[model samples]
Target: MTTYHVQIKVMPLKDLLDPQGKAVLGGLHNLGLNGISDVRIGKHITLQIEAESELSAKTKAEEACKKLLANPVMEFYEIEMVQG
Candidate 1:
């Protein structure tokens, strides 16, 4: 088995409500940081896994994201795996 690095980014669907993101966006305006519009917050997860090859590592990462890292109903995720 080879060690792999996995990164998962989970983001809300376009139609989902992101209160935390909205709040942050509002605060940006208060801090005089304009031109930043449409703020949305999600989750960033990084981990190490053991797999046979790049394809195996990617498949495992994707499974992990779908099973626990992201909510299919409201969120989507992008997965990246690199040799470690």
Candidate 2:
């Protein structure tokens, strides 16, 4: 088995409201940071996975996201296998 680095991005669905994002946007506006029309907050996750190959590492990371890291009803996830 090889140790691989995986990065996962979890974000809210586009159609759903992101309260934390909205709050940050409001703060930005209050700070006079204009021209930025939108803000969407999300999660960045990094995992060290032990697997036989990059594909296997990615698959394991995907399963982790689907099972525990992300909420399918409200959030979506993207997985990237960096290096082994």
Candidate 3:
């Protein structure tokens, strides 16, 4: 098996309101950062997976996101296999 690096990004659904994002936006505004109109907060997950191939590593990472890393009802996730 080969060790692969996987990255997962989890974010709130576009259609849903993100209170944390809004709060950050408000804070930014308070700081006089007016040029930025929006802010969204999300999660970045990195995993070192042992698999036979890159595809296998990616598949495992995706499954991890679907099963536990992300909440399907409120969040969406993107997975990528990174070369290290």
Candidate 4:
């Protein structure tokens, strides 16, 4: 088995309301920066995994995101794997 570093980014779907992002956008405008638009906030999770190959590591990381790191009903996630 090889140790792999996994990164998972969880974010709301486009149609979902992002209150924190909206708040940030509002604050940016308040600070006189109105050019930025459609700001969004997301969660970044990083962990280490043990797998037989890169493919297996990726698969396991994706499964972890789907099962525990993200809420499919309200959020989507992207996963990245690297040698650890």
lDDT of 3 by residue, 1-84 (tens): 999988899999999999999999999999998988668899999889999999888888888998899999999999988897
lDDT against true structure, model 3: 0.91
Residue pairs whose backbone atoms clash in candidate 4 = none
Cα misplacement distance, residue 39 of candidate 1 (Å): 0.6
lDDT of 4: 0.89
My TM-score estimates for the predictions, one after another, are 0.92, 0.94, 0.95, 0.89
| Runs in model 2 lying further than 4 Å from the true structure | none
Give the range of the ten consecutive residues with the poorest summed lDDT in model 4: 75-84
At residue 20, give the lDDT of candidate 1: 92
After the best TM-score superposition of candidate 3, give how far the Cα of residue 42 lies from its true spot, in angstroms. 1.1
Best by lDDT: 2
Of 1 and 2, the candidate ahead on lDDT is 2
lDDT (Cα, tens digit) per residue for candidate 1, span 1-84: 989988888999989899999999999999999999999999999999888888988888888887888889999998887556
- Identify the candidate with maximal TM-score: 3
**lDDT tens digits, residue span 3-62, model 4:** 988888899988999999999999999999968999999899999988899898899888
Q: Which residue runs of candidate 4 sit more than 4 Å off their true CA positions?
A: none
